[model samples]
Target: MDDDIPTRMFYAGRRWQVTDMPTRIRDSVWATEPGTGRGFYGWRFQATDETGESFVFDVYPGAEGWHVHHCYA
Candidate 1:
């Protein structure tokens, strides 16, 4: 992450560019991965492909790196 912000990503055989400002999401009710206390859970942002298809993604950091937790098309 560049300064803890998401800019672009490649997923589903296509490159996606973040179209809107990213918002950090915190989970106080659930335990965060790789940490004991509540901390940075993930990021929520809208992205678009070259074909102009857009999706909202929820991504989180893990021991293996970043992961796409969910996506809303």
Candidate 2:
């Protein structure tokens, strides 16, 4: 992330450029089944691309690193 904004993202073997600051930034956490001592944290955003198309993108922290979980066009 650059200046709290995603500058680029990869999806479907291609890279998409984030042209504007993300809107509606949200965060959440989910508990795992039955006291497994595990949970998941997520961050979601609605942003526009350089081509003027809108998309929903998500990023989550995992054991390894931050990952792009999903993208909706």
Candidate 3:
């Protein structure tokens, strides 16, 4: 298993290289199941391309595959 954390990804049909630390998204300190939606949630990170265009992205895995939940310019 590759335990290494992800620092880059192909998003928006482009190379979005992570430029900042990938932060794990977590729910509040309540609830149950799925580890209380803690680290089990997903991730948010910022990335930029070769042209320096950047975006903030939120992604998570569904039954199919990793899906982009939202994005910000």
Q: Give TM per candidate.
A: 0.81, 0.49, 0.71
| lDDT ranking, high to low | 1, 3, 2
Candidate 2 — which residues are off by over 4 angstroms? Answer: 23-41, 46-54
Cα shift from native, residue 6, model 3 (Å): 2.5
Candidate models: Cα lDDT each: 0.86, 0.62, 0.72
Q: Candidate 3: which pairs clash?
A: none
Q: Residue by residue across 12-69, what tens digits does model 2's lDDT show?
A: 5556676555653323244555456466665566656555677777777689876777
Indicate the residue-level lDDT of 29 in model 1. Answer: 28
Model 1, backbone clash pairs (residues 3+ apart or across chains), number: 0
Q: Which ten residues in a row have the lowest lDDT in candidate 2?
A: 23-32
Better of 1 and 3 by TM-score: 1
Cand. 3 Cα-lDDT: 0.72
- Candidate 3 lDDT over residue span 1-73, tens digit each: 0254457778767887888888777664222365545543667889898889999988776788667778998
- Which residue pairs clash within candidate 1? none
Collision count for each candidate, in order: 0, 0, 0
Most accurate candidate by TM-score: 1
